[model samples]
Each structure stands twice: as structure tokens, then as C-alpha cells.
Target: MTKLTSLTIAEARAKLRAKEFSALELTDAYISSIEKSRTLNAYVVETPELARARARASDAKLAKGEGGALEGIPLGIKDLFATKGVHTQACSHILDKFQPTYESTVTANLFDAGAVMLGKLNMDEFAMGSSNETSYYGPVANPWRRKNSNATLVPGGSSGGSAAAVAAHICAGATATDTGGSIRQPAALTGTVGIKPTYGRCSRWGIVAFASSLDQAGPIARDVRDAAIMLKAMASVDPKDTTSVDRPVPDYEAVLGKSIKGLRVGIPKEYRPEGLSSEIDALWNRGAQWLKEQGAEIVEISLPHTKYALPAYYIVAPAEASSNLARYDGVRYGLRVPGDDLIDTYERTRAAGFGREVQRRVLIGTYVLSAGYYDAYYVKAQKVRTLIKRDFDEAWNKVDVVLTPATPSAAFAPGEITDPVEMYLNDVFTVTVNMAGLPGIAVPAGFSEQGLPLGLQLIGKPFDEETLFQTAFAIEQAAGKFTAPQWW
Candidate 1:
């Protein structure tokens, strides 16, 4: 019998096809792993019975020769996605008892593709914090650590739990949403491969809104190939979500080993800004050199708007988040506190239910969208976002793909950033891609001097996941396999 921890999605499928393993057995293996690693706090809730039932059904489909690529694979879903009947808290007290009647379109699509639901993973409350500490459920511990170092380092957020769970080998892959640096940041911190598919590639119908314009759902997996397989299944055109693109989904796995010979890889001069750590700068340069040696043509490019991305994103994201989160008043789903009057009830409920960081973002968002300041802040931010996107469009005209550092530094200790603005600066390299609504992927490139994992991001044209995956796959081959934390 093959142990589940060592298996990949492709390997698991092969075993199932050979009748060497049953879906029930695979589910049991994952459930057992989750039980053994309970201290990691990867999952906010466990739905083993639901998973097993789905696994049995998947086995039946396989028996009838009706299964697809992801048939019977147990997967973790980030709590930000609304899973019908599952407590889909965005790791906040505000949504403590909130359960949706309908599943998120991305979640529903994954189930339709034969993926069994493992459970919802934890995240930063309202997806606001870079570190997972802001989560009402508590911080998710990093799976990796140096020999003498403590194990309490952050797993990264707001998709921290998803990355930790995958790194811990609890699931073959997990669903993740990236608004700013959520998915890729966590993946980088935990030594996993995560891709933020082209904005609008994955449906956002039932996903808990963060920054509406920047939020995109993608897959976090052990490797690029697994991430690509999961992404193909998760993407679709949903009539319910107006933002869902009408384009046909490409077969992402078809181009796995596609040659990158003569492919133009743009190196943005602005990514290595003044504050970048020396180790990270060296890693980025090393990665570029490696790619050049692999037959890729590296060219220097300028995305002059890079400096404005962080500030523009902060203004735009919070402004949109403020608008999207307005539905959480006392009446609807979420928490409601009884009070003296209607106004008091709304104020009391929000104040009591929301976390400090969530409240902070709400205030920032509210202020930016306030009556007198809308044009000065929100409107100007939108204009800057347009310039960021235009920068990519012009660069893509010269190069097939752009390569840059996913983050300025490696994962930091939880609570290391006392100042909120300083913490927000962590997403500088990643926010621009979201602002531009383009696809970006973070793959493990190397490790820092402190032994923390470093990630290289590949940004591609809109709806051009094929090129993105092809480029990442080549990098993966060059980087070799990433080692997970010894806790596994």
C-alpha cells in the first residue's frame, strides 16, 4: 500500500486507476495525518465524514470509468471560500457562525471535478494581515525551521493554513485566494508552489470578498504540475459571477515540459528596491542567471509604476473592501449583537465581532471612500492601477514573460511587525500584479542565509496561464525538488 504522505495528485490518480488504492483509503490516510498534526492549526474545521462520503461516491464513479484527473483526491479549502454547510469563517469572530446555503463557484467546480472536501483552513481575519496572527483562530505555525530555531514562525497569510496543510502533506493540494500576496506569500514562506491565476480566470462568486478587484482564487500544491492540474479543474465560466471570464479553459497539463528556448524573460529593474534584503537580492540574481543558462533570453525592463503599486493597492484594496464588507451589518448572515436601538445594534455588533486589524482596514477603507476624499484617494488609486496594468501590457509586447521576486524578504516571526503600515509594505512586489489583473505564480527558487525559503514570481499576460505554467515548470526543473519541514 502506498503511504498517502508521499503521493502527489498524479501519483494518486495512477494508483486509483490501477485499483491499487481506493478513495476511502486515501481519505483515511489524509484524515490520519490531520489528526497526527493537529497542533499545527492548519484546518479551522474538519469534515471527515463529508470527505469520506464524497470519496466513496468518487470511487463509484471511478468504478464506472467516469472519473477525471482529480477524482477522489482529498483537498483543503481556504476558509475565505464559502463552503455550503461548512463554517466558512474568514478566521474572524464576525463570521463565527456564518454558513452559506450555496457553495462558492470555485468550490463547487472542484467538487464537480471529483475532489473530496477535506475541510476549511484558517487565515488572517478578513484576509487583511500578512502574518496569520491576525486570525481570530490564532496564528498558523510554519512547518519549516532551522535546527535551533523555535517552530512558532509564521506560515504566512491570509492563505497561511492552506500552505501549511499542503507543506505538512495533509492534502495533495488546497484551494487558495490571493488578494495582494495572500496565496503566493504563504507558499513562499512554506516552500510550496502556488499560482495566482490570471485575474478573473477563476470564478469569485462565493468567495468571501476581500479586495474585490484584486482577489483571485488559485491552487497551492507541492509542485507546479500539481498546481496546474488543480487550477484547470477549478476554473470555469459561471453565469452567476459577472466577473467570471467567458473564455474557454485551456488544458494546462498539456504544456508541462514545453521548451522555453528563445523565450523572452523580462527582469524588472524596479523589483530590487532599496529595502530588499541582501540575501533575497542575491537569490533573485542567481535565479535569473540560472534561467539564462537554460536557454532563456533575459532582458532588462522598466515598470516605473512599481514604486506606486504598494500605496495605490492599499488605497484601492481597502476602499473596495470597505464597500464589499458593508453587507456584514447586524441583520444578514454573520454576527449580530442585540442593543438599545437599530444604530446601536449595528455599531455594537460590528465592534464586538470584528478583530482589530479588520477594524483598522475598515476604517482605512471607509476614510478613502469618504464623501470629500473619494476623488483624491480612491479615484487616483484607480488611475494609478491603470498605469500599472499598462506597464505590463507594454512589457509583454517585448517579452513573453516577466520574472521578479515574489517578496522583498522571507517569512518573518509572528508579531515582528508592530506597525501596520510596515507590515503592509511586505506585499509590495506582489500587489502590482493584482492591480494589473494579470496572472502571477510563485515557485520556490532557493533559500535565504537563515534557511528560509525564497520565491521567484513569474508574471504573464491576461488569460495566459499556459505560458505561465510552462515557465514555472521549467524553473521547477532547474530548482529541483523543494524540501519540506522535518515535521513531516
Candidate 2:
């Protein structure tokens, strides 16, 4: 008998519809896994009672043959989303006990589609940092370890917990946000499928604001089909979010095995940056070969602004973060430390509440947005951002999709890189897509010398997630799923 937790969402859904197992059984299996895997610290808050209740409701719906698309699929919600009345803190102490009365548009859509909530997964505090180390809830240990080494590794940021949970099989999929590669990088590290849909594909309304312009919601799942299904439920135009495009959502799963016979795949010259690992480079070339074997035409294209994307992303994201996070000054909600005066209270509360990484970004953001340095840093970065987009726009004319390594290297043990600059380099390959507001999917392609998982990213045109699903499925068919040898 296979463990229920090992089944992907697609498999679980089929079994549930065939009456092979109850949603209650599925939910209980996940809850038991969550309880046992607490040492990983993937979940900041456990909502067992809520999950059970939702699972029962789903069972009832299935009994009536009226189950929604996600009918009974259990999922972890990244702490960044507001899950009405449940713990939703974005894994930051500044948002202490901050549970919303209304649901985030993405999570709300999931719930509407009958997805059960496992709990709030851990993340970088206020979605800052490349590693999960900055979370006020503590860092999430990657489910995968180097072969024969007991040393724990990071699952990648800020969606580290989301990626870890999926890899650990605590949930079938997870709701994750990408503000400069949070979703894709973590997925790459954990060997899960993650998609950062076009910027407006998922609504920003009700999500804890973090570089709002760059932030978008997507799913981290065990496989590409599950990711496609989850995204179909998670993405929709919402009246509450004006940024959400008013386009009709397509059935992404339906496009999975579609032929890419004449598909043009762009191999970016700039993506082979200075320090890319040979293992990752070989894996990227292998992925390209696999796609080409399936009839994709590989073309060498250049996005020259790719080198400037990371620095500009740092400037733009933190600047917006500083502005967005300004509301957490202890006056309204969350942690508040009193001071001798109102100004002092604001200063004390912020300084005390925010983690070190969060504080660093806020200061950088404030400095960049400050009057004297605005044009030189923030405004100039915005101009660079435009060039980044134009670079992608130009590439689209020659290629249908862009193929690149998801991360420069495989998962590294936590605290391996102490320097902030070194850590920021993790996003070197992923940030460009975010800057361009393009749809990107990370699919596990191979492993490293240490036997940790590595992935290749597929970047598609804006609002063209269906094409990404199609291409990613072809890669998945070739590389197959890589699961951790369960150590927990």
C-alpha cells in the first residue's frame, strides 16, 4: 500500500472521485505528517481543526458529485497570504497575531475551489532574504540533504517552507508568492514544480504587501500537472485587485502534453554568468537537449540587461517594501513597543519588530527612495527595469520560450554563505523574469555532484502560462520527478 501523502494532487483527486479514499483520510495523513515533521519548522502555525472541518466539507461535496476543481486537495498556505481568522503573519514578528477577517484573493480562490488548508508555512520575514533564515518563525530546513551527509540544507527563500512542505509530501501543493524569485528559486532547490505566473495573473489584494508591483502568486507542487491544476484554481481576475488582468483563465492542465514540434526555445547567452556551476550548466544543456530531442528548435538569444536585473530588483523591491511595510509601525496591529514619545514609539517598534534582514532592506529601501538619492538609485533602477522588460520583449520575437538554469547551483546547507552579496547572487537567474513580468516555471531536471536536486527554468511571454505548462511537461516527461529519500 502506498502512503497517501506520497500521491500528487492529480493522483489524489482521481482516487477521491473514484471513491478510493475519503478526503478525511487524506487530510489526516497530512496532519500526521505535519505533526511529525515539526523539526523542519516548515509550518509556523498548524490549523488542524480548520483542515479537518474543510476536509469533511469536501467529502460531502464529493459525495454529491458536485466537488470543485480542487475538491479535497490539501495544501499549505505560505504565511504571506491572509487566511481569514487563521494565523497569517507573513512569518514576521512585526505582524504578530495578524489574522485577517477577509481572505487573500489567491487563497480565497483556492478555498472556493475546495482546497483544504494544512496551515501557514514559514518564510523569510516579510518575504525578504534569499535564504529562509530571515523568518521570524525561524529557518525551514530543506527536506533533501546531500547524499550520505546529515547536514541540513536550506529549501530556499521566501517560499522555502512552501517548497519544503511539498517536497516532504505534507501537502499536495502550496500557495506561494514570488517577489523576485521567491517561488521559483525555492522550488528549484526542493525539486518541486513552481510557476510564477504573469504579474497580474494572481491578485495582490489581501496578500501581505511586499514589493507589491513585483509580487505575484503561484503554486509549488509535486509535479507539473499538479502545479497546472493548482494555478487554474489560484489565478483569476478579482474586482478587489485592479492589477489582476481581466483575461479569462485557461485550463493549463489541458495543454500539458501538447506538441512543441516547431517550438522555438531561446538559450540566453547572458544567463551563463561568471560563477554558474558546471553541474548546473551541464544540467541546463541536458534539459535543452531533451527538449530539442522532442523537436524544439534551440536558438541562442541575448538579454543584455540580465546582468543589471539583480541590482535593480534589489533597489526596486526594497524601495516598494519600505513603502509597503511602513504601515507596521506598531500604531495599528502586530507587535508594539512603547517609547517616551510617539516618534520614539514608531522607531522602537520597527527596530524591535523587524528581523535583521528585514531591517537591512528597509534601510536600503528608504535610502534609495530618499530625495537626494532617488534618481541615482531608485529612479535609475526603474529605468533599468524597463530595459530588462524590453530585452525579454525582443527575445520573444525570436523564441517561443527561454530555457535557463533555475538556480546557479543546487541546494546548499544552511548558513553556508554568510555574506549578503553571495546570498543575493542566488536570484541571479530568476529575478530577470520577475522584472519583466513574464511567466516562468521551474521543473526539476537533474541532480548535482552531491546528489541534491537541480532544475531548469522555462520563461514564457506574459499571460502565456499555458505554453510554459506544455514545455515543462515535456521536460518532466524526460527528467522525471526527483523525491527526497525520506529522512524525517
Candidate 3:
């Protein structure tokens, strides 16, 4: 018999229905896997009791021949989402011990589809850093190690733990939110599949806000087929969130194995920045060739305002973050530090609660949104954001989807990047998709020279995730699935 932890969600679903193994047995295998892989620090909280209870219930449902789409699958939830009566902190000191009475719409949808919760996974505090080091829970270690190296590497951030958990085989899939490169970057680094759907594709209600306009929820899984299955269970239109799209959620898994013949695939010229690694460049060229062999027409295109995406994202995201995070004062909930007076108390509480990166971003946000600088920074970034979106809007006239390297390189050592600006550059290739409110999927394409994983990104039209799945499957089939050597 295969190790239960190594089976993908689709295989488990079929075996579960066939009564070959009980859901409780499968859940137990994952619980044991989590216990053994503690060095990765992927999970911040372990809800074995809850997971077992859910699995037993699923077993009963399966016995009755009545189960939802995700009927017996166990998944990890990112700390950013609110799970009723469970720890819901965004891996931040500020939200210490905070648990929501209400559940996030995305989590609720997953549960409605019969998914079981493994626990809350770690992430960057308030979804701020490019690497997972900013988490109050400590950085998540990538399961993959460089050739002949024992040095630990970062799994990429804000969805670091979600990606790490999927890569490490501790969870069937994970719910991850991407504000800037959160989902795709981590997946790229860890040899997993991650998708950030269009802005309104998933509801933001009950999930802790990072940047209102930029944040969107998606899934991270072992493979493209698993990712498609999980995304179908996670996405829904919620009346509680005004931004949630009203369109019907399609069966994303249905598009797998579809032909991409004559599909015009756009290759953005601006993405090939100077100083790009030769390994990444070669892998990218190989990806285009694979697509072309499958009858996809590769066309060179331009996203002229691509250079401005990073700076504009920094300005716009923090501006909204400052406003959204204001509700976390000592008076309401979470941490509190009493002081001389009301204002002093506010100052002390926030200072004590927020981590350094969160504070830095909040300060930047406050400074940009201040009286004199509002028009100069925030408004200007918004304008630049529009132009960035316009560039994609124009490109849509020529191609059905755009392709690019997911990251500049593979995973790096935990503290290798100390300078803040240098760390911000890690998101250079990924932020544009968020800025444009487009759906993007990162599929593992090849390995770096040091044997670390690298991925290729696919950007699709608004609410057109089906095409992304179709195209990404082509890449997956060509490149073959990648897995870590299981040193952990």
C-alpha cells in the first residue's frame, strides 16, 4: 500500500469512496506526518481533535453514499483566514491569541464542500514581507535543499507555510491569500502549484485584510489537478463581501487535458530583465517551446508600465493596509499595553503588538496618506496602477494568456537577503498580476542548477481561470511533477 500521505487528493477521494481506507485513517496519517515534520514550522497551530472529528463525520457521510465535492480531504488553512473558534491571527504579534466567532467565507465554503481542517499555517505578519522571516511564529523552512547543502532556505512569503505544507506532504492542499506575490512566489520556490484568482473570484469577508484592493484568496497543492480541485471547493460568491463576483463558479478540474492548439500565448518582453539568471532564462525558453509544440502560438508582447508595478504596489498596498489595520487598537481586541493616557495607551499597544515589518509598512502607509503627501504618492500610484492594467488590457487584443518566469531565482537562505529593498525585488515579476487584478497560476517548470525548483507563471483574463488550468496542465504534462527528496 502507498503511504497515505503521498497520495494526491483525487486519488484519495476515489480510494475513500471505494472504502479502501477510512477518512479517520487518512487523517491519522497526516497527523502523524505533521508530528514528524515539526522542523519545517509550517503549521502555527495543530487542531488534531477538530481534524479527527471532521474526518469521522466524513466517514459517516461516505458510508451513507452522500458526500460533498471535497468529502474527506484534509487541508491546511493560512493564518490570515478566520476559522470559528480557532486561532485566526495572521502570524502577527498584534493579533495574539485572537480567535474569531465567525468563519471566513472561503473557509466556510471549503467546509461546505466537506473539507477537513488540519490547522492554521504560518505566514508573514499581516502579509507584509517577501520572505517568511517576518512571521512572529518564525520563518518556514523550504523542504527542498540546494545540491549538497545543509543550509536552510526560505519557502517564500506570505503564503510560505501554505506552500511549505503542500510541498512537505503534510497537507492535501492549503488555502492561501496573495496580496502581492504571496501565492505564486512561494509555490515557485517550493515546487508546488499555487493560483491567485481574479480579485473578486473569492470573498474577502471574515478574512483579515492586508490590502483591500490587492488581496485575493486561492489554493496551493501538490499538482495542477489537485490545485484545480481545491480551487473549485474554495471559490464562491458571498453576499457579505461587496467585492465578491456574482458569476457562477465553474468546475475548474473539467478543463484539464483540453487542447490549447492555436491558443495565442503572450510572452512579455519587459519580463526579461537584465541580470536574470541563465538557468531561469533557459527554463523559460523551454516552457515556450513546449507550449509551441502543443500548438500554442507564442507572440512577443509588451506591458510597458511593468517597471512601475513594484513601486506603485508598495505605495497603494500600504495605504490601504494602514486604513484596514486601524481597527486593531488596544480598545477593541487582541494585545493591549496600558499607558499614561488614551493616546499613550494606543501608541504603546500598537508598538508592543505589531512586528517590525508591519510597523514599517504602517508608517510608510501613514506617511503616504498624510495631508500633504496624499496626492503625490498614493494618488500617483493609483494612476500608475491604471496604466499597468491598461497595458494588460491592450495585450488581451493579441493573446489569450501571458507567460513569464515566476521568480528571478529559486529559494534562498533564510537570512541571505538582509536589505529591505533587495528583498522587495524578489516580487518584481509577480506584483504586476496582482496590480492588474488578473488570475495567475505558477506551475513548476524545472530545477535550478543547485537542484532547487523553479516555476513558470500563467496569467489569464478576468474570471477566465479555466484557460489558466488548461494552459497550466500543458506545462505540467510537459515538465512532469516535481517533489522534494524528503530530508525533513
Clashing pairs in 2: none
Where is model 3 more than 4 Å wrong at Cα?
none
Candidate 3 or 2, higher lDDT: 3
RMSD of each: 1.2, 0.8, 0.7
| lDDT at 246, model 2 | 95
Deviating ranges (above 4 Å) for candidate 1: none
Residue-wise lDDT of candidate 1 within 201-242, one digit each (tens)?
899999999888899999999998899899999999888888
lDDT tens readout by residue for model 3, 256-370: 9999999999999999989999999999999999999999999999999999999999999999999999988888778889999999999999999999989888999999999
Order of models, best lDDT first: 3, 2, 1
lDDT tens per residue, model 2, 1-488: 99999999999999999999999999999999999999989999999999999999999999998899999999999998998899888888888888788989899899999999999999999888777999998889999999889999999998999999999998889999998889999999999999999999999998899998899999999999999999999999989999999999999989989999999999999999776778988999999999999999999999999999999998999899999999998988999999999999999999989988888889999999998999999889999999999999999999999999999888887789889878999999999998989999999999999999998999999999999999999999999888998888
* Model 3 clashing residue pairs (backbone): none
TM-score ranking of the models: 3, 2, 1
lDDT of each: 0.89, 0.93, 0.94
- Candidate 1 clashes: the total is 0
